[model samples]
Target: MSDPTRFIPVPTPETAHFWEGARAGELRLQRCADCRKAYFPPRAFCPECGSREVRVERASGRARLYSYVINHLPAPGFTAPYAIAVVELEEGPRMMSNILDCPQTPEALVLDMPLEVTFERLSDEISLPQFRPAKGRAA
Candidate 1:
């Protein structure tokens, strides 16, 4: 596989705003003016109803750990024993982001576990959104 982070965004001109927001520690989703459906990985046209009018909407940064795997041996530039997860953002879009700030084990990274987004600065123009366990979990 290629550099995980590089392959992640796959940005286009239309998605620039969304990626920029992530770098700034904000979660942004695209909303269609016509159908009012929120979308992930911002696009020029709304995923629903095929509306051309869309706007960037800030998100609550809350998500659920939809699914994940603990990578014991990872690609170059990735540390071993990290959890890579598909987080279902509260906005209802599922994204591939790493799970950080938590134990990288099966027991600790369960499906449907509440999570929140955090950004790691990769470059001046780019950042990676990772998730961690949501607060108030039992010890």
Candidate 2:
């Protein structure tokens, strides 16, 4: 569980499954049945082929750090000097999340560093997926 001061996300009809998956300790993504492409920020239609033939699939929970910025300013539910990052999922989609459980430093947060998903439960209906450095992997 995160601090109560943290901003909680509300699940909409299109994103309910994603939240549910996080609650169950899974990272879920949508794939287009027509184009076979995976995408994030769950939507009803595929962004590539404009097809509604999409299915939700559990992701490998593996990713690599693509980009990030070390935040030095205070924010609700977050301490200063945290990394706000974008991770490229193994499924070929990218998602924004916070980097935790490691030193928040540039030298420590290398681009292309291996990462794995972890969840922080904010509520009964919301468990936010975050990432951390992969075990047994070097940056």
Among residues 3 or more apart in sequence or in different chains, the pairs in candidate 1 whose N, CA or C atoms overlap within 3 Å are: none
**Which candidate has the top score in TM-score?**
2
State the lDDT of candidate 1 residue by residue for 1-139, as single tens digits: 2444554545679888887898789988888999988887778999879989988889999999898778887666687888777999998889988887777788888889888888877666678777888878611
After superposition, candidate 2 runs with Cα above 4 Å error: none
Off by over 4 Å in 1: 1-10
Q: Tell me the TM-score of each prediction against the true structure.
A: 0.87, 0.96
Q: Best lDDT goes to which candidate?
A: 2
Give me the displacement of residue 71 in model 2, in angstroms.
0.5
| Alpha-carbon lDDT of model 1 | 0.81
